[model samples]
Every structure is written in C-alpha cells, then in structure tokens.
Target: MSAAPESPAERQAIDRLFNPRSIALVGATERSIWSIAANDNLRRFDFKGSIHYVNPKGGTIFGAPAATSCAAVGAPIDAALLMVPEAKMIDVFADLEAAGVGGAVILSAGFAELGENGAERQRAVAAAAKGAGIRILGPNCLGFANFVAGAPIWTTPLRRPMADARVAIVSQSGAIASQLEQFAYQQRVGVTHMISTGNEADITIADAIDYLARQPEPRAIALFLESVRDPARFAAAVQAATAAGKPVVLLKVGTSEATARAAQAHTGSLVGDDRIFDALCRKLGLSRVHSLEELIVTADLFARLGPVECEGLALTAMSGGMCEIMTDQADAEGIAIPTLADGTLKRLREALPPFATPANPLDITGAAMLQPDLIPTALAALASDASVGALGFVFDAPLKDDARGFARSFIRHIGEGFKAAGKPCVMMSHTFSAVNGEAREMTDSAGVIYSGGGVRHGVSALGHLAAHHAWRRRAAAAADNVPAAAGTTNAARPNGERDVLDYLATAGVPVIPARLARSADEAVAIALALEANVVLKIASPDIAHKTEVGGVALNLRGEAAVRNAFDTMLARVREAAPAARIDGIVVAPMRQGGVELFVGTMNDPQWGPAIAVGLGGIWVEALKDTSLRLLPIGEQDALDMLAELRGTKLLDGFRGAPAADRQALARAIVAIGQAALALGPDLVSLEINPLLVDGARVEALDGLTEWKESE
Candidate 1:
C-alpha cells in the first residue's frame, strides 16, 4: 500500500464544530436520562449562540420548536449534536448534509469499537460524512466544550464556565476528557477548550491540537493520548503548537502490555512503538507526563504562568524539616534548586535573624510568622536572584472557622509577595487545604498559584515545568539546523560486511584494518601480512547475522590457522545457510584492551532514522541496555546518549578496565549519524557491533548495512 498524504486537520470544519454560530440538537427530547443532556448543557452553560432543536417527532423540545428533519428546518446548521442511535445515523447525516451542516458530534457507540463488522459500517459513516464535506467529532464520544466561545456541547456535567482561559485539553477518551475537565475545575485550572476525540474516525486528537494551536486564546494544550493515528500529522500539529509559542503537555499511555492491546482495540491501529513516540516527544519539545493528575497540574503551570524562564528553583519555608523534604523531592524530580547567589545571600541574611542561614531551600525560621516583612523581603531577594528560575513558599491553611482568618491573611501575603517579585511563584502545603476555593481565588486574582499535593507532586510539577522550558530552548536552537534525511526505504536490501566497512571508511568512521579474500590462499596471505593475531569472518550479503550462522572465527595466530579457520568457516556457513550466496571472508588483526560497544541506525516507521548505542558483544541483546536518539544529532548529542547508558561507568575504567576513549566514541557516533543522514530514505539500518574502544582509539570491529533495493 502507498503511504497516506500528509494531510492537516480540517480547520474550517473544526471551527464550525467548536465555534459554531448555530447548532442542531439531533435526537433531542425532554424525557430525561441524557436524551437531552447536550441541550441541557448548552443552556446551562449559557451558550451565546443559536441552537436549533431536531427531533423526528416534530414538536417542541427544550422550549424550542423542533423539526422532523434537518432539511425541513429550512436553515443551515453549523454543527449537529447527533444523539441518535447508531443504525439511523446515516439517514440523519444525509438529512444534515442536505441541510448543509458543517460538522457532527456522533454521541453513539457500536461503531469501530465493536468488531470488523462494525468497522465496515464505520467506514461507510466516514465516507458519507466525507462525501458531504462535513467533519465528525466521534462515533463514540462525549463531544466538546468551547468555554471561551461559551459553547458547551459536552454531554457530561460541567462547572460554571470560565472565560478567557489559556489551556486546551485534547483527549482521545471521552470519559478521561470529562474527568480532566472536572479535575481542572477542582484544581481551579482554567481551560479554554475541552475536546474528546472519540474513535477519531473524522477528527483526531492531532486535528484538535492543530486547531487549538492556531487559536490565540489558548497558551497551552494538554493531550491525553492512547496512540497516534497519523504520526506525520501529529508531529506537524506539535510543530505548529511550538511555533505558536504554545506548550503542549502529553499523557501517553500504552507502555504496559495490557494497555497496548487495549489501545489497539480502542483506537484501531494506534498502538505504535512507544519508544519511538518518546523520542519524537523529546525532539518536538512536547512535555510528556505519566499520570492524568500530573498532566492537569503541569498544564495549569503553563496556562497560568507560561513557560518557566529560569533553571533553578528556590524553596523557602519556616520549618527546616519541610524545607528538607521539599529539597529532596526537587532533587528526585531533576529540578535544580541552586544555592543562593552571594549578593542575594547577603541581602537575605540582613533581612532575617542572625541565626538564619541563607541557602537554597532557605529556612526563614519561625520568627517569620510574627515578622511579616521578613518573609516578603526574603522572597524578593530570592526572586531577584539570577540563579533562581522560580520560587515557592511552603505553608498551610486550615479549613477550620477559627483558623480561616489566618489562612486568608497567609494566602494574601504570599500572593502579594509573589506578584511583587515578578516571577512564577507557588504557595505550597503538605495538604490540599492550602488550595481551598478561597485560596485559589486569591492566588488567581494575584496572578500566583497554590500547589497542595504535598512535596511529592508539588516538586514533580515544578520539575515538569522546568523541563518544558529547557526543551523549548533546545528545540528552538535545533530548529535552525535541520539534519539531512537518511535515505530509507521499506524494501529489503542486504549489504555484505565489506560493503559496510567501505561506506563507513569513506565517511571518516574509523574501522579496523581488514581485507576481503575469496580463496584460502589469499586469506592466508592477508593474515600473514597483518603480522599479528587476526579475526576472520564470512562475507555474504544474504547472511547479515554471521555469528548466528557460525560464519565467524576469531584470534587465528598463524597463516596455517588462518587458512584452516577460513576453510572451516566457509564449510560451517554453507551448512548453516545453504541458500545464502557466500561472497568471501574478511580478515583483520585482533586488537586487545578495548571496551565493546554497539552503534547502530534504524529507520523507525514513526520517528524516522534513529541512532542506538549500547554495550556490545553477546551482552548487547542479553542486557538490552541502550540509549536512543533521533538522527541529525551532533557530537554533543552523541555524548549525551553515551552518558545516559546504564553501563556508562564501564567506559570509565570500571573494575580496573582501561578507560575507553569517550571522545573517539562520540566522534564515531556522529560519523555514523551523519552517514545515515546522507544516505536518506534508501537506507534501512547501519550497525557497528563491537565498535571496540581503547584509550584514545576507536575502531569499528564489525559492521552491517541494509538498504532499499532502489539504493
């Protein structure tokens, strides 16, 4: 099958669905039990737009005159909330199309989620909608809410509408979207848009993100993803969002075996390789969170304050124990809470008691409770410190009536201080009481925030916020330097080992000295000329994994041993792979005191060319310890990849082993990546197994390259 065209979301149709001037509520009824839930939500949310009720009975519904058919209504409907049954959907859609409806929210199940039979019917539904040039939100979804437009077509209950919010939640699951919406309300996280892309038969999560990216009202987008249906479209959408200076937080599931299966069944063909998805996220500057709660909280930070500007976090608290706990959590989350600057430290010392030490996670001591100015002064100093990226104060507000006055005062002081500092700030507490409605309202008014999930979640959210900011900077820098594409293809093109070595050598990648010989006498002559212990391996294009086929012999000392091993290798390989057309054998001098490493390239179907490095030899597969990065990477990127390896210490003279040449290893990695990029789409993969690295020396001991037949 040919590849699908790189198509963007139907923006006009999506706009009609979310920003519709007029809507038709199909299957509307006053009987109750969700038959008219969509209508009720629209009215309750005070949708500032026209709503046309549609029912086949042709009577009054929701205090509006109903029409039997959309065509009979004699007016154009921008969006249709189809609460009708699955079987009658085609007919209703036909009438809707005849009436020139632009979009539809199919709040019915029994479509693709059922089985192949249902999937066939779904294809027809998609075809009908496409033929009519209308967009669909779902075949099984709760619909969406355009809070900024005052349009809440969602079927689930919602809190009072919040206008002019900055975050748009785009989700694949209807229930999860609704749950997030409610969670946002509870956390006082204002959301401008909430979209549930159920089934994604017409409009997918990517479509929603793309549409939201172009909208100015939302400063951030939170995505709850099970899988990506169209990777190209998804990537384009993310790029658009990043270009628009919008932060997108993604909650991608399917890491577990059961979830992967469920994801495949839930959204047909959506369970892509999760690792590639992760690499894509890193490349695109999209923040990926594990849990829905983390998604909500992290998005709230972005929506409220935008991206974090600084790299270090400054924590302040009266209790040393609480400060220590917050510090530990911050470290665990990879959030750098740097030491206070000398100037800031001096200022803080002068503003506090003599006994108070000025440092990161500054302990202001209990005296700050009485001396209100002390806390604000310390905050101002920390906020102004160049090292501090963001600042947070740990405090609590009890819900008791007697303590209410103190709580209000504490919230007001913290909010006022943080606002005065002119930096992102948070008032944190060990309990959720610190985020009461009153507190949230106060912080919202003061342009501050209250994080109340204790030190764990509070620090985690801060870490995510910092990472989002850092990734954006990296992505922006890398944007100016687009890496050339690695020639790749879907067809199989096997390359012999000598061909791989020749290609790498031309590209400046270091390779062991080797010569290919077609006869035993030639092999003996080549080994004798090497003047040292040597390795011999069969060279055959059809036999990529030569070791598995018993085609390799190592450490042959003399000409006699070399000739005998060469003959024996040929015989064993022929016995193992009779169909393989053996070309010759490769002979190279054996080198000692080197760390074995694997460097390889892969053409991921979703992410494109990627480089992988790990401990090589037999342990490569057994340990499965490796690091991966997208291609077009530079020397620094290669070094970073190596640093992430679980066995990175092995290269640093682990267990009295000589330290491997890290600089040379990095250069080799870069060379491999550059070669892959130059190869472009025709190249399938290039692997250098056991790229032996001794002190200040690196050599590709064995190599393999695969490409397309066209190449």
Candidate 2:
C-alpha cells in the first residue's frame, strides 16, 4: 500500500488503492467460483462500498445490469478487479485508464510465474499499468482484505471477523494466505489485514509491510515468504515495523545451497539461500519460526503480550503430570522456568493445602477444583516473584456446552488472578485444540490471552518472546559499535596468498611472516634468516588448495632440505597444473599446535556481504558446523557467532591445550569481514583458513581471495 522508498504522494496513492471506496469486478459471472466468492465475501464482511459488475459482453450479472467495461460504469471507480484473459489485458487496461481507475488487481495467470515468455508478457502488462497511472497488486494472486475497514476484495471463502484483531498476515502464495487466515481464526487470533503478494510484479511484500507498519491496528506481522523480491525495500520496511514496536515473524521454505556454494573456497560451501535469510533476520530483529502453527502462535503471542521484558516464565497446572510435561517442553525450548522466591513460596504455602507444594511449574493439587478461588490465590503469589517475567496457567478452554457448572467460576477466578497479578499472563490449553465461540467469549470476558496451540507450541512461543526481547537489546547495543569498513585505496591488489597477508598486516591482523624466494638459492637464504624449521609453499594466484597440487612442503630445516623442497615442489606443481602462473615459493617458519579456525566472507547475490566462522582444516567441510552473519558486524556479533558454533568448547583449552583468547579471535573475525568488504564489490570470497588460535595468540596462518571475472 505505502510503496515506501517511494514519494509521499505515491505512498498516499497506494494507500488509497488498498482502501478504495468503490470497486469494479470486470469478469463477474454466475459460473465462476472466484466471482461468486468475491461477491459473497464483500456482502458477508458488510463492506459498505459501491460494487460494480463489468463484462466485455454486457448483461445481467449478480442480479444487476452489468456494464460492458469500466468506461461504461459512468462513475469514478477507485479500483478494478481484472478477471479477463491474459491476452486481453492490454485492451482492458486502456478501458480502465480512460475511465480513470486508480488501481487494478490482475487475477489473470500466465505471467511471470511461468518463466521467460510469461515474464516478457508480465513486463508489458506492468508497462501498460504504469502508462495508465494505475497501481497493480498482482497478475497471479488472491486479492487482499482490510478487516478494520470492512473491505474484502479477496476471492476465497471468508470467515467472520474477530472484533479486536491485532495481527496482520502477508504471504507470497494466495493459497497460503487463505490457510493462514483459517488457522488464525481457528486459534481465536484475530487478523487486521490479509494480503497475498503472488507474482509481485507491481506491489511487492515490502510495499505491503511498509504500509502495515504505519497502521495502528496490527501489533505484530506474520510473513510466509518463498523469496525476497526487493532486498533494500524489505530491510527498510522491517526496520520501520521494528521502530513501530511491532515484531515480525517469518516462516520460509527452500534451503537449496547448490548455487551459493559453487566457488573455490570453504565459505561458498557453507553459504545457502536460507542461511543468508537467517543472517538477515538476525540483523533485522525478526523472530523466525519453522512451522505454520508456530508462525501463527508466535505472532499472536507477540501481539498480545508484546515483549516479555525479562527472561523467565512461571507456569502452573492442576495436575503434576501436566506440570512435568510443560517443564520438560520448556527445557527443550530453552525457556527459563525460574524458581519462585522465598516470599512467593511462603505466601503460596499459606494459601495452599498442606499437602500441596510451592514451586515454579507448581502443581496446585485437586484442592483448587472444589475451592476454585485457591487457584487464583496461588497464581497471584507466583506472579509476585521477582524472577517471573511472565506467567502461564495450563487450562484447556472449554468447547460448546462445556463452559457450564464449575468451569464458569473457575475461569472467572483465573481472570481475577490475572488482573490482580498485573503481569503479562496467558491461559494455554493442555493439548492442541481450537477455541470455539463460547470458549472465546469466556476468555475475552475475563480479559485473558489464550492460545489453543497447547503446551508444545505455546511453550515455543514463550521462548520466542524471550529470545526476541534479548535480540532487540543486543541489536540496539550493536548499532553503536559497528566498525567502519573503509579499506586503503593505495593498497596493492592482493593477487595471491602472500599478498593477502601483506594486506591484512595493514589492519593489525597478525600474519605468519613470509618472504618470496624466486630461486633455490633464495629459498635457502630465507630459511637461514628464520632460525627455525621453515615451510615452502608455491605462491600462485591461480592455485587455491596447495596440498592437492603438491605445492606445499611443511616443516623443512637446513639449506639442503629447503633448497631441494623448493625446486621439487615447483616441478610437481608444474606437472599437476601447467598453465598456472607461479609467483615463486613462499618460505616461512613452521609453527606447531593451535586451534584451527575457519573465517570466510562471501558476496551473496541477494543478501550482500556476509561472513562464516567455524573450526578449520578437515573439520570445516567434514563437520559443516559453522555460524554465519551478515558483514559489517560489531565485535559482539562476531563473538555471538563463535559462541553459536558446535565445536566452540574446543576453544576453551580442550585436552590440556592452551585456551584460545576468544575476544582476540572475535576481533580477528570482525577484521576479516571488514577487510572482505574493503576489497570492494568485485570480491567473491576472502578466506582465512586454520586461523591458528594458539593460547592467547591469534594469527592468520594462510589467506585466500577469489574475484569475479571481468566481463
């Protein structure tokens, strides 16, 4: 709606398009399900706008005289739903433009989603819409609905509104939009807007998010994404939403790494499409979930509770078994279930039956079943604990005809307990179930936030709440300390391993000292100066893995051994890769025993510069256990990335070895990322393999850089 990064006037125009006062259904017919559903939804939603039916062949449609075209309507039409054939779009747009239609929803298929020819056709249609001064949503998509405004342009069976809806759903697939709406309503989670951005030829998901970010209705946004169409707009829109204090939750598919991993470095092997998106999410403060149910539950909880502000959850249940189940799941989800303070326990003990205990995940015992008021008393005491950020009670909401007898009084007291506590609290189901209207009314009357996802999904949602809160603080702090990535312009172009070390040395990154030896005599002379065992390596910009080509000879001492190895290694490399351009041998002292860390940077086609850090050597490819983040990261972000690695424990002096200096290592990782960015846009990958973290020392043992070929 607000196509942000667009002018203010343009944003207002798009906003008007989404909330149009009048509509024209161009292909309305009795035989088409789409047309029937569209009309039915408008009526059901009580949309109080003028609706016009138009067809190429004018006739009676929807019990009204249908206009032959938009021009024949003889009224200022704000928006038109074009249900005509793809081939007829050119002519139809002409008619709409002449009639001064401001926006068009192209429901016709056979556009960009079909590939080359379809893409070409879509381009033409986009041009036509632009020439007509109209904004378009999609040529292949289910239309949108604005619940707050009572507007329904959607062409699917619509559910009744949830009066106080606060979450908005945006999806790439029309079908997924429908599914999300159905699920959201089923969970008793109301939605303010539902938009399907299928084949986003004109208005993309970024435009939708940017528009929604300005609204006061939706407190949290849920995104079902297949891919990103505009990275810059997407980032800006998410930032706007974050600034608005609205959390964005994303559920995406497709994790193919084949294309991103096609390079001559280890970094490429670890970079995937989804990993890049994951890195972007971390940078943007988005809560990412994996399942459809998680997507809704997390967003719903985010909307209802906002951020938890603290890191712990206090839970209660009637049965010991249920309490155990919730605790186990909480532990699994990494949710902190803090123990109640002494004062909280004393108050709980005073109010509870003698046999009952006072603990976090406390079992209230069946005594509360008869004396229902005891439940709220226990809850109030639990909520008083300083360790509890938020509290939850596992009470399954009743279905139809079940909200009678003791249940009514029980729910009322639970509501009283929630109010008296004055904390963010929720009533969760013991098992996954839907909230019927009667149950919904019962909870709403008590002012209780409820989730039918029950224990598993509900606990996971709490975990997300805490995690997102923590991320926001970290992201805020990180913003202040991000180091600038300006590289020296006069620095020599790094063509090989030796040149890369020279470049890194300028940035305070310690590198293994080395010298170029053009001949056997030069190799022996370089070895004599080192005063220790030296290693000889072929220095060629064209060669990457030196071991495979026999271009590396490690731990050689004395003039005889150094001279023989340099001459023999060159011969071997020539036989293996004859066309490679050799820049002579690199002779350096051979040091032993250190933690091998792999730090690499990649220029992603979609996410831009990013870096990966993990255990180096064979473990890099064999374990494939690495952590990634978008580049230009602060030292704390780099530290967080290292902490996320599975083999991170090895850095703490494993098996009686020297413990690596993590702060020093983190700075090194950040420096490498900055260096990679400074190499400019032509860089494909910059790698520091086996970074050699020995004791308190960290140095770059070897370095490599790959560049894009000049076209």
Report lDDT per candidate. 0.78, 0.86
Residue by residue across 1-711, what tens digits does model 1's lDDT show? Answer: 022433444567778888988888888888855656677788787887788888889889877799998888898788988888888888776788799888999999999999899898888999989888889999898898898888877887777776447778999998999888877776667789999999989888878888898888998898999877776788888888888978899999875343233222211122234655676777777888888877887777777665688678888888888888888877766689998778998898889899898988989998877777687788998998998777878876443424446655666677767866778887766754434466566555655577655556666777777777787676666565545554542233436888778778887899899999999999989988889898888899788678899988888888789888988999999999999998899988988776898887776655566777888877777776777777777666677778878799989997777898787888888888887667666666778888888878899888877665552
Model 2 residue runs over 4 Å out of place are 1-4, 256-265, 318-387, 401-404, 485-492, 557-561
Point out the worst 10-residue segment of candidate 1 by lDDT: 262-271
Looking at candidate 2, the ten consecutive residues that score lowest on lDDT are 256-265
How much does candidate 2 score in TM-score? Answer: 0.93
The superposed Cα distance between candidate 1 and the true structure at residue 127, in angstroms, equals 1.2
Off by over 4 Å in 1: 1-9, 255-272, 339-357, 397-404, 416-421, 432-434, 445-447, 488-494, 538-582, 649-664, 677-684, 706-711
C-alpha lDDT of residue 167 in model 2: 93
Q: What's the TM-score of every candidate structure?
A: 0.88, 0.93
Predicted candidate 2 versus true structure: per-residue lDDT over 1-711, tens digit per residue: 122468775576678777879989989898999999888988898888889999878899989999998999999888888888899887788898888888878888999989999999999998988888888889898899889988878888999778889999999998999999999989888999998888998888988898999999999999998887778899999989989988999998886354356434458666555777788898888889998898999899999986677778888899999889988988876689997888899999999999998888999988888898897788889888888878888888787645355666678888998888778888889888998888888888887888998888888888888888888888788778888655545344587989998888886788889989999999999999999999998999999889899988999999999988988999999999999999999999997887898898988876678899998976888887889998788899988988888898998898899988999988888888888878887888888887989998898988898878889
How well does candidate 1 match the true structure in TM-score terms? 0.88
